[model samples]
Target: MDDSKGKFGFFADARRLRSFLRQSWRSADASMRRGAVVMWCVGLMFTIFGVVGDVLETWWSSMPFLTNLLTSLTAFFFAVPVALLVLHDVSHRMTDRAGRRAAMAVLAQSMYRLEASVSALGPVEHSRHSPTGGPPLTTGSILEAARARFGRLQDLEGGNAEDIREATETLRTAIAQWKLDRLPDQFIEEVGRVDIEIARLRDAVRPRFLQSDLEWPLDRQLHSLAEMANDLIKRPEQWTIESYNEWCDVAERFSQDFDQKSEITLLEINAVFDLLRHVQAMHIRRTTFVQALHDFNLSARTALWELSSL
Candidate 1:
């Protein structure tokens, strides 16, 4: 006997091939290995039924059709379960992918809204500190006050679109009233226009899963800016030439760097000087919110990747 050959030479290579295939099967992932075993068992059952049916056909010539029908039914029964399993797995994967994609899109869109709102400030000046060299416009006290007003958004998990919209509308009214009291000559008209724009944006806000991921943070930043501005406005004591110069410093910092449209006018340049401090103070909070949003997006992507792997 040759070491490589069996009793028959033809069996040698075929035996090695079977050994190799078994090794390959053992190397597969646990779930896939189980699936392969199940399918192999089903295939073996079908093959056995076919052989048995053919053997029976020789014994009963008049009933050969019955055996043939049994053989076909065996294949059908086995195929139905495999097909259904495949369809179910495919549907589950698709639904999972779609859900992750929708969540990511909603988060991105909410970030976009905040980005646009921030850009609406145009260019901010370098000096973000207070004019008298005290605390900045967005002082800790001012932020605490803003947070007091927005309890839900400051600590939100989830909310319906209508309820969030209503809350934002109420916030808008409060900010508008504060503006009327402080900068009545400028912000009275400006607040109305801002309200109209805000209404349009709010109405356009659609329902989304994980929507609070964006809404709460973005609203928090906006409210903080509003509160800071109102706080600055209330200080008639600081309305000195130095404060005016600090406002000028920030307002004059704007150039055609990013946006083409200029919201600042020579007539309201004085008002813009006053408005500039709020935007300047908002820079820190804006950066904080943006970093938070970035982390959120990263987490969402990681979840999506994990889902894909599964």
Candidate 2:
């Protein structure tokens, strides 16, 4: 089937040209279409005027005015419209191509950054990805993985290394199953890998990304996370004995300075609030990733690798 699609000859070239013109004409601005209509009318008028002027010139053989009028009409209508049309068409095409390239570049960058956020989700793979070199994961699998990991997280007693490890692995498994279209399988597939895939997606749509949905959200999120660091410090990635002692010392000092009841309440409330915010942010990022993929209009079954010739 793919081979057949690749076959191209005179008829194929003609078909492609027809398709291009048809799509371009359909997508063209109304003013441009109107201008095309005006150009066609001008050409027809030029022909008609030249014919009538020739008859008048013949009738008044000695009159230079009739001949000059015909010549001027031909030049004014023919040369001017043709030049304007050429410039308009070329400029539109250049603008269109530039817009598409920029959009693809944005997409490539988003995919790169989004992949980094996915690490928090564990080893989820796109439907086309096989992280372990085993098999491609699917969307269903990733969604399930997210569910199960959330469950595991809830079940944890003390957020011990073992519990976090199991939950993390489960998270990975579900994601590996998710098969986001070749994600976890090769997330390092940034810029270089994603660029090729973005190029493919852009080419498939004829690079018509006149505008993009991905404005500055990626940057905004990163900056927000950096600035909001103090908002959550419930469970650091690692809790050393020294840090535990320090925390205990701080609690003792606070209790000595003030009522221990309020200090304890404050600590509990702060941790819970921080944890809630962190969880909320994580889930939001997940949905954002999913939404971004959906907005890209990527085929459900088309994995990044399968979609493009990397």
- Candidate 2 lDDT over residue span 77-110, tens digit each: 6556445555666677787667655665555555
Clashing pairs counted in every model? 0, 18
Q: Which ranges in model 2 have alpha carbons more than 4 Å from their true place?
A: 1-24, 56-72, 75-90, 110-310
lDDT of 2: 0.45
Query: What TM-score goes with each of the models?
Result: 0.34, 0.34
Compared with the true structure, all predictions reach lDDT values of: 0.44, 0.45
In candidate 1 the C-alpha lDDT for residue 61 amounts to 57
What would the per-residue lDDT of candidate 1 be over residues 1-310, giving only the tens digit for each residue?
A: 5655764566787887677555554444577656755765776787786787568776645677876776676676556545555555566556756765675565456445544444443222222345468965432333333333334433443234443444334333323323322322232233233344334333433233334232223344344444444444455434333442343343333322112332223333233323533533543443343344344335445544553464
- As a TM-score, model 1 comes out at 0.34
